[model samples]
Structure formats: structure tokens, C-alpha cells
Target chain A: MISLLQQEIESQPEVIARLLERETHHIQQIVAQLPPFDYALIAARGSSDHAATYAKYAWTTLAGYPVALAAPSLLTMYQARIRMAGALVIGISQSGQSPDIIAVLEEGKRQGRPTLAITNDGSSPLAAVADHVIELHAGPEKSVAATKTYTAQLAVMALFAAALSNDPRHMEETQQLPTALEATLRLSTPIMQAVERYRYMDRCITIGRGYNYATSFELALKLKELTYLMATAYSSADFRHGPIATIENGLPVFLVMPLGATFADMLTLAQDLRER
Target chain B: MISLLQQEIESQPEVIARLLERETHHIQQIVAQLPPFDYALIAARGSSDHAATYAKYAWTTLAGYPVALAAPSLLTMYQARIRMAGALVIGISQSGQSPDIIAVLEEGKRQGRPTLAITNDGSSPLAAVADHVIELHAGPEKSVAATKTYTAQLAVMALFAAALSNDPRHMEETQQLPTALEATLRLSTPIMQAVERYRYMDRCITIGRGYNYATSFELALKLKELTYLMATAYSSADFRHGPIATIENGLPVFLVMPLGATFADMLTLAQDLRER
Candidate 1:
């Protein structure tokens, strides 16, 4: 029996492929229409926030724009008058119903700053409030745990990053991501076996760095939401700073280190944790 | 015999008072000397990172400068070119050590952006690279878990917030903060009694929002570093988004709700958690 969650999970490659194929020109047009901005202020919650986290690395690295994750409570609750000058305000949401995320875009619009929303629902209030809307087009996400929308949001961020960079290599790599995701999904059988070993695991920590920092948080959120596990995510460097003390004899620590510039540091931490 | 951690914790009021009295003018001068900047990018690790979290809210709300906590790995591990134009790069570290943080300030200086260091050690490498330095005059901090330096860093953030605003009332309130700390410390006896109840607690989540969001992380870090408890911190808004499902019977949860605009929303979350 294919669970809706599993179906959504397996559909990621297709969803991302469709997203890139359908939205590449649209995202490029959106980027072209935008005014010159010095930085990006992104407002999101839950899995969308993790997408923003990925964008924090992606936008800064690829597009040369510093990205900051906005604390929506500052606008909605504290009524803070945050300086939005020279900022491209962005809101990322699936349903786009969250008032806090919407309030940030509204504030950005009120301040006359350019606002953009990346959401699954183009008709959502979040999209309505933004100067530009990048629809996920991942179709209806009914699993309630946000499996498809999360990846779709990441796809949108990758699209925006490529658009902003205007580099042929970046665009080619963006186009190839769905194939990479598809190949990655083929290893689920071994991953399922590995999960069997941790059937009784109640709590754990997820560690990643650089772009995968978003992967760490997203993984933790999925574990918490779907498995009802108390999973906390930390950057590998931050985990070393103090929480390394929390590691004992039999505790589980998940490290999300992809092969990249951050691999060596994460490998060192993994070796250290393994020795413990 | 009092534990070293307890003694250092008790010294927070005096440490903060000494910091405010000495560094207020210095911070003002640093702010005045700075070339006008559009935003602030801060880098830190461990408890110092929590202090940076406080400044993210403080600088945005009081000073009207959007604050972004920088991912140091971008500069260090990835060797990524980040646009630092119009950014006042600041690094906060008690020891002013962490090469990752200094790397950020160094890159900021390389990009011709103004840089600042908030550290207890004026002679450290971080201070050497910064255009200006604000010393946390909390004297010698011997505790392993960072008790005095955390509050002192918060004091420095408050002072900077006050200095940037140039509002006399903000300065007056900043001056009186140490007195408030002293008053709050009087509740230690009850807090001690409450601690006894959680003696067997192995894991918990700390929640806060707005300015006190930093307090939640600081408290969680202290718990992890000192008590070896698996404590995670989340903003109340973020908590409701998903991790709230982890709240089962007998699970310990800490909420840091300071009296402010965020109080009511926190109270609602508190009530929801209490019912659970």
C-alpha cells in the first residue's frame, strides 16, 4: 500500500521537473521585472522556513545577495518598524494562509519595497499581498505533513537563484536537479532498512552545514511531524559548540553532509561522534 | 559550597552593570563613527549566537536596521563570495576566538564594509580585524557554560540598540537594566525549588518570542551545556507550526514570556500547551 506521504515523496522528481519546466521563464520574467535590491528578507514558517534557509545559502552564494530570514513575530506581534529599504521582501508558504507571514509581505508592500511570494496556491492571501508570485504548481498537497510542497518550495528557490544569477551553468544544473532527486529516491529500500534499526528511537539531533543546513531542519521537521519524534537540528559547527555534550553511549545523531565544501568539517564531526 | 556556574550566574547583575557603565559611551562612539549602513550581519557561535539572536530583534525594532545572523561557513568552508555592501558586519564572541566568526568580519573588511567586534577580549584576533570593537568588560569568565558573558553580551546589544536610537528613554531604561536583573535574581529561591521538580527531566523545549527569543535559546543552551539535558528552543510562533506535537504528558516545556507585546500570544500558546 502506497501511503499518501510516500506517494508525495516519490513524486518529488516529477514535481520538481514540472516546476522547472513550467516556471523557469516565469521566474526569469519576475526577476527581470524586479527593482534593484541590495538584500532579501524572507518570511516563512515550518518547512517553508527551511526553504528560506536553503535560499539563505543559495541566494547569497549564487546571486550575490545577502538573504535574511525575517522574524514574523516582530511585525505581527511586536509591530516593529523594520527598515525595508533596499530589500526584496519574500514570503514562502504552501497554503499562504499564515497571517504572520502575510503581515511581513504587507508591511514590505506598505514600505514600497518589492515583495515576492513562493507558494503552492497562487490564489492564497500571501500571493495576493506580494508584487510577484511564484506558484509551486506541485498540485494539491493532501498528506498534511508537507512532503511535496517543501521540495517544490526548494525548487522555486533554486529557480529564483538561477534567474538572479543569469548563468548558463546554474540554469543547466537547476534543470538537472529533478534527475538527481530521482536517482536519489532509488536508495529508499536501504534507507527503509536503516530506519528499521531506529524503530524505538524517541529523540535525536540532525546536523548539517552550508546549503544542507536547510536539509537538516527539514529532515528534523519531517521526523517530528510524521514520526512524532523529538528531533532537533543544528549546524555541525553549532552542535560542536555545546550540544555535543548531549551525546552519550547510544544516542542517535543524524548528519546530513552532502559532498561539498562543508564535507570535511562534517566528516571530522562525524568521526568524533562515531568515536564517542 | 556554591558551584562555579551558580556564582557566575549570580554575578550577571554586576557584570551587566559594569558593562553598561563602561561601554555605553564606547558603543555610542562606535555607532557614530560607522559609515551609514543599511543592515547588520552578525556572526557568532554557542551562547554568543543566542546574543546575536537578541540583537536580531533589538536592532530591528529599536534601531530600525534589519539584522541578519550570518552563516560563517559560507565564508570559511564554501569560500563563497557574499555581497557585504551596505552591511555593518559584527561578530560577537565572549573569547573573541572562533575562526569561523572572525572569517565573517575579515570578509566584511575585505569587502570594504564597516566591521565591529563585541567581545570580552579586546586583544583577540576578532578585534584585530574589526574596524571597531566593543569590549564586554565582564572581567574574567571562568565558567565553562558561559553565564556572565551571555548577559553581558545582551547588555551590549541593548546598549547598541539604545545608542543607535539616540532616544534618551531607551538609554535610561538600558541604564536601569542591571537593577532589573538584581530584582529578578531575588526569585532564585523559588526557581531553585522548581528546578528540583525537573531533576529527573531528560528533555524539554524552551519557547519565547520577540526579544526574549534569545532568552529561550540561551536557557536551552545552558541546559544542554551544563545539565546535559536535551533542550531545544523555538519561537512560540514556530513551535505551533509543528513541534508542538511533541508535547506529551510529563514532558517538560519552558516558556520565556517577558512582559511585552509578545506576552499575549505566548500566553495563548502556554494555555494550549497546558491543556495538552
Candidate 2:
């Protein structure tokens, strides 16, 4: 099954390539249409939401755009006072049909804010309402669980961030996504092997910081949805205050690392866990 | 802060009563309009997503609708073929702006499926595309860490299932939700006090069954998100497989019991853990 999925993923390089090109083009268009906005309100759910979160960080850090992640319920129920006049609402979803997302986007439209949809479904309702639509060509995935589509969404969002910021640096990094995804797939074997070892674990804790925070979140979800494992995800930094009390010998801990300044600190924490 | 939250929640009975009437009316109307379909698909993220997972069980058992929980990535990236042409797509969100939920709703619209959005923001993008919107009247929850909205969503979904299946059994039971919530809130002091007692532990495991399965899952999420704790949630039945190997002295195990059938089983498991 893993090999089949890997094969399926490999066959979609062109789709990934096309999706990258499309997002790149759409990013340029969004940059050209740069609405006078103070911040970007990004709305997304599940893995797509995680990708949007990554976009939030990238947009804030790279593009100097203030971004806030909104819960779909807040936009739908509260009619909260959003300073919408100068805000760009970016709705990210693969299907572009979730009722809450559509409602939020429609509300954004009603409020006269420009809305964009990053999706794979061109004819999706979100696309219909979006001022601009960036289509992802991930093709069909049969598993009830998500895999390739998540990587694809991340890739597109990375490109979107690059285009929005008009930062060549982000663009360069965005271009490396497909290759990164390919390399990441190699890690899947190790991850799967590791998961199998702890498949029957009463509980598992996944920890990461910064961009990888959502990575841990998504990983925990995958374990629950697929293997029915009991797992939780958390920011490594937050673990010290009170949560560390939950950790004990023999409990499985998975830490996601990105090469950065925080790596040293995370390593130290991991070492501490090992010694404990 | 927790006490303040409890006070606020206790004061909301009148508000919850009003909201319950409105939600029940909306749920009835939507369920009447639902086309014949094989199963239901719930798409959501974060706390709302956790509520939806609980709803999945309610829909399956109460409404007799085989329900599938969808991550937005599947709809957008993996292209998982949603099984029913007339399937009900229920999108749950507090803000109603999650991008992926919108994408899924967009896809459902393209496929001509009925879409329902349960959200707090009626004017948000998610409500805009929804055929029916059940607005949660949980007021403006200001905490970045969700508490009221989560419970409110669960309450609404429970009522929704009761309405959909025309089973007033749970509806009558649900009327006690606010009271139950208050009682749960009262237990908070004791629970936290208990937690404080074991705060020195490095990790803990929470287990439950049936609908409480998701309860365990959400508990883990809350523990991690709020306290940054390394907590894991597991099914009571699945606990003994291999995860029990890690169970030993000093490791805290929290078990949630359902109302009846599974309650005894959970008690047995707790006893076993105590003995271990």
C-alpha cells in the first residue's frame, strides 16, 4: 500500500509542477492587485489549514504582512467586528466547498474585502466566489487519509507567500518545495517504521516548534484517523511549564526539527527527555 | 481565570436556552431538506473539528447516517471521492473562515450536494455558501484557547443529531447540557486540583470509548494546547494491545466514561491500571 501510494505520488510531479506554475502566476496577479490592506485574514481547515498557517508565518515574516488565523465558527456566528475594509481574506481549501468556509468568504465579499481561494477544485463554490483562484492539481487521492494533497497545498501556499511578498528569497525557497516533498517522502519510511513500532502505544506525544508546530498537529491527526492511535501534538517550548509532568519512561516522543536557531534548544530538550 | 470562565459559563443558561430554540428550529428545517444519501461528511478543524468528530458518532447511531470525518486536505489535495451524490456536508467552525472547510464546501456545491454550516459567525464566508446555517450563540469567546465554543458546538451538534433522527430521546437529555456543563465546570476545581497533585509526572494517558473516543482525543488536544502537556488519548478497548506495556507506577491515567454501558468497562480498566 505504501509503495502504491508512493507510485501514485511520483506520477503526479507534472501536476505538482503545473500547480506551482499556476500559483506562481496567481501570486503575481495578487501582487499586482495589491489591495490597500493592513493585514491578511487566512481561513483554512485541517491540513489545508496547516498550510495556511505556514503561509501566515511566511507572510508575516517575509512579506511583512500581519496575518491572523480565524476560526470558521467565529466568522460565521459572531459577526465579529473585523476591520475588513483593508483586509485580504484568503480562504484555503482543497475542495472549496465546506459550508463554513464559503460562508466566511461570502461574508468577506459582502463586507467588500477581496477574497482569494487556493484550491484544487476549479468549479468549487469557493472558486466561484473568490476574486482570484489558484488551482492545485493534486489529482485524485483514494485514501480517506490525506498525504500528497497536504504537501501540494503547502507548496502552493509557499508560492503564494513568495508572490505576495514579491520576495525572490521566498520564491527561491518555494520552488524547492517539490524537491522538498520528494525528499520528505523518503522520511515517510522512517516515520512509518517508527509509527509501527509504537502503533499500539497507549499514548504518544509529538512535539515541534514554530513552523513545525502544525506539523506535529497534523501528524497526530494522521495517527488517530488512520491507525486509531492515541497521540497528541504540542509546541516543544510549551512542554516545560506543566505538560512535561505527563511525560514518563517508555512513552513515545516524536520531535520534528527544522534547521534553525531553535534546533539547539529542541535538541537539548530531547536529550533531557532521553536522560529522564 | 478558570473560575472566571466558570462564572461566565454558569451565567449563560438563559442565553443557551434561547440559542437552543433557534438551533433546533434550524436543524429541523435542514434535516427535512436533506436529500437521501448514504452517509454524511463532516469537515472542520481545531476545536470545532473535535466537536464534529463527536457528531460523527451521533449521526451514525442517532440519525443512522454512516458518517465520515474529512480532513480538508483529502478534499483539496488527495481528491478522495466523496461517496454520496446527495450527501450532507456539515462544516463546523467557530470563526467559519478556515480555508479548507470552504474548499470542501465549494466541492460539495460543485457536486450539487446539500451543505450545512454550523458556526458562530453567520455573516462569515462559510455561511455565505451554506444552504443552511446553524449559528452558535455562544457569544464572543475571547480566549484564544477555546472552551465555551467547543462545548457549545458539541451541544449544538448533539441537538442537531437529535433533530435529524427525530429521536427526541437525546434531545430531552441534551436539555440538561447547560446543567451538565455547569456540573462539569464545578468539577473543574476538583479536576485541576487533582491535576495539580500529579503535575510532577512527566506524562499521562487519557482513555475513553465510543463517543468518548473523540473525547479522549480532544482531551489530549486540550492538555497539549492549553497546558503544553504531553498527554495522549486512547480508546479503552485499544489500550491493552501494547500501549499497556508503558503503564507503570507514577504514570497518571485519566479515563472518561460514557453514561452507561461503557462506564462499567472504563471503571474496570481504571481498576486494572490502579492495580498495575
Candidate 3:
């Protein structure tokens, strides 16, 4: 099943490219429509929501937009304390038919709020309600679990940032996304191999910081979802506060050392984990 | 610092109550508007994000609103490919001054969407841009670590749900929230005392399902945050897939059991964990 899903993902490269293009266009259109306000609200659920965290860092530093991420429950279920008179609500999902996502959009419309949706299914209820719709175009993800859609969402989001900021340099950088994804797919082999080493280990700690913090989270989620591994994600700083005490010689600690300003700190934290 | 923070939190019951009342009234007024929309978007950070997730369940089942949660990163950095129009964007925060949150709201506004801010600080940038404001009366949360504010946010959200649905049943149930919180606080005493028993244990797992699943995640977060304990949270069924292999005699496993549908299933799982 994993292999089949991987194939489905690989076959969707064109879909990814198209999704990125459409997302870029939508963002540019939204940017063209109104005056800049305070910040952007990136709303999603499950794996797509985790990808939004990654988007937060990319948009803030790369696109120079202040952003905040939230779950829909806050608006629909929570007392309508939080209000947006002229803010974009970007809803994301693979199926785009979840009742929660639809309800959120309905409430927004009644309030005369502008809403958007990114989805794999163009005909999904979410798409029907959205003022603008960016199709993921990843095709049918047969697995109950999501993999390609996740990466596609991330890619599309990155492209959207490039479009909104009108940064040609960033846009060019996004062109490399497919290649990077391919490279990442290759890298997963070694990671899977490494997993065999820890298959017998009692517990696993996955650690990263800053933007990579979400990567660590997604990695842990994937490990749990795919391999059913018992793993926890933590920020490098938080790991030292107490989780490290459990390091009894040879416990598995998978560290994601993504290149960024925080790389040195993360490396140091990884070293500390090893020493412990 | 931790003790001081704890003291401040304990002493703020009156403040929390007052803030709760104020915020509840504000939410009622907002939901009464029930503006036409397709979906709701909630943007929040940190503990407030957790409260948002808790609200998602209530929104879907109780108020019958389709909602989606988002991270600010998607809107600010990645410009996530989401359809944004006719949707309400909600920004939630205690301080409401996080640069990312501001950026996301600004982006949403530029898209001509309705924006809302739910905050402890009405003067914060988040509130400054919001079309509607639900000010959390949480008073001053002195702790860098949030406790009472999180609980208060949950309470406010619950009350908001009740107000929106015009269903006082949940509201009446929630009136017991303060007492339940007090009981939970009291229950923690024994859990804290018992922490010593498992502090030395090499591994710990926390499991729950449905709403309690979020509780399990929060519990793991607390354990990691407060004690630096390496803990993993999982849905009860998800645990069986692969994490169960790690279960053995002497490994510590914590179950956050709610008195509902999952009780029997969790009991069986607990027995399996014990046997393993």
C-alpha cells in the first residue's frame, strides 16, 4: 500500500506543477483585490494544517507577511469572539467535503466575509462555496492516509507566497520544488533503512526547531501513521527541559537538521541528545 | 519562576471569571450576527491554538457549522493555495501581538475578507485590524507559561458555542466547568505525586480518542513542557498498529480516559498494554 501510494504521488508531478500555478494565480488575484490589512489567516485541518505552520515561516520571512494559523473550531464552536470583517480565510483540505470546513465557509458567507479553499477535489462542497478555488490536482489519493496531497499543499502554498510578494527570485526558487521533492523521495530510502535500526528501540524522539519544528511534527506523524512507530516531536530547546532525562544509552533520537539560521542550535541539541 | 507562575494562575480565578463573562457576552453578540458565509476560519497560536482545536468538535456537531483551523504560516509565508472569499477569518491570541498573526490578518484583509480578533489585549495589533473583537477578560497572565489563560480560552470558546447554537444545554453543562477545572487541578496533585513513580521509567505513552485525544496531546505537551518527560500521545486505536510493540512490563503508559464511549475500548487496550 505504501509503495502504491508512493507511485501515485510520483505520478502526480504534473498535477503538482499545475496546482502550484493555480495557487500562484489565486494569491496574486487576492493581493490585487484589496488593501493590505494586518495578517493572513491560514486555516486547515489534519496534515494540511501542519503544512500551514511551514507556510507561516515561509510567508513571514520570504514574503514579508505577518501570519497566524488557526483551527476552524475556534470560529464555529468557540463563542464568536474572534472576528474578521475584511480578512481572507484560506481553507485547505484534500477531500474538501468535511462538514467542519463547509460550516466554517457558510458562517463566513453569512457574515459577508471573503473566503477561499484549496482542495484536491474541485467538485467538493468547499470548492462550491469558495470565492476562489485552487485545485490540488493530485488526483484521487486512494490511501485513507494522505502523502502526495500533503506535499502538493506545501508546494502550492510556497508558490502562493511567491505570487503574492511578486518576488521573481522566490518564484524561481519554487521551480526547484519538484526536483527537491524528488530528492526527498530518494532520501526517504535511507530514512526507512534507518528506521529498521530503531524498529526494536523502545521509544523515539524527533526534534527540530523554528520552521523545521513543523517538519519534525510531520515526520513524527508520518512515522506513527505509516510504521505505527511510537515517536514524539519536540523543539530542540524543549527537549532539554526534561525529555532528555529518559535517554538511557542507545535510545533512538531522530533529528531533522534542516539548513536555516537555527541549524547550529539544532545541531548542538542533537549532539546533546547523543551525549545523553 | 514556575512556582511563581503557578501562584499567579491560581490567584487569577476571579479575573478569569470576569474575563469569561465579558468574552461570553461579546461572543453572543457576534454569533447573533451569524453573517452569511460558507465556512469559518480560526487563526491562533500556542495554547490558544489548542483551545481552537477543542472548539472544532463543538462547532461541527453542535452549531452545525463547517469550520477549518489554520496556522498563520500558511497565509503569511507559503501563501497556501486556499480559496479565500466569503469566509470569515478569526485571529486569536492572548497578547494578540505576534508578528505572524498580524501578517496573516493583513493578508486576509487585502483579500477583502471579514476579519475577527479574539484576544486578551484589545489594544493589540490583532484587535486593531479586526472588524469584530472578542476581548478575553483573562486579566494579566504573568506566566510566560500559559495555564489559566488556556483554560479560560476553552471556557470562552465553549460559551461561544452555546451562544451561537442558542442551545443552553451545553452552556448549562459548561457552568460546571470551573468546578471541573478545580477538580482537575486537585486531581493533578496525586498525578504530580505519582510522577516520581514513573519519572525514572525509560518510556511513557499517553493515549485517548475523540475530544480526549486532544487532551492526550495536551497532556503529553504538559509533561514535556513542565517535566521534560519524553512522552508520546496517540489515538487509542492508532496505538495498536505499531506503538504497541514498544509496550512491555515496566514501561510507563498513561491513559487520559474520559467517561464516555471510549471507556470500554480503552479499558481493553489498557489490559492489553498491561499484558504486553
Error of 1 at B121 (Å): 1.1
Q: What tens-digit string does per-residue lDDT give for candidate 2 at B1-276? A: 456555545656645666777777667677777776545667787667778777756665566444445545444333444433435777888898888888777767877878888888999999998888888887777655566677778878788778766767777887776676666656766776776787666467889766776788778777766665667777675465445656667778888985654677788888888888
Model 1, DockQ value?
0.76
Among all windows of 10 consecutive residues in model 3 chain B, the one with the lowest summed lDDT is B75-84
Instruction: Indicate the residue-level lDDT of B197 in model 1.
Output: 85
Q: Each candidate's lDDT (Cα)?
A: 0.88, 0.69, 0.68
Cα lDDT tens digits, model 3, B81-198, are 4444656677778898877777657766888778878788888989999888877677777655677677677777777667766688876776666566666667767877887767
Writing each residue's lDDT as its tens digit, candidate 2 over A1-276 gives: 456556666645556777777667667777788676655667777777778666645554455444545454343333333334445778888788877777767877988888988787889999999888877777776656566677777777667667766558777776766676667667866876766766557667788765676788788777666555557677675565346766767888888977864577679889989988
The true-versus-predicted C-alpha distance at residue A200 of model 3, in Å, is 2.7
TM-score of each model, in listed order: 0.97, 0.54, 0.64
Which 10-residue window in model 1 chain B sums to the lowest lDDT?
Answer: B72-81
As a whole number from 0 to 100, the lDDT of residue A3 in candidate 3 is 74
Off by over 4 Å in 2: A1-14, A75-83, A187-196, B1-276
- lDDT (C-alpha) at residue B254 in model 2: 85
Worst 10 residues of 1 chain A by lDDT: A72-81
Runs in model 3 deviating more than 4 A are A12-14, A21-27, A34-37, A74-82, A186-196, B1-218, B222-229, B234-276
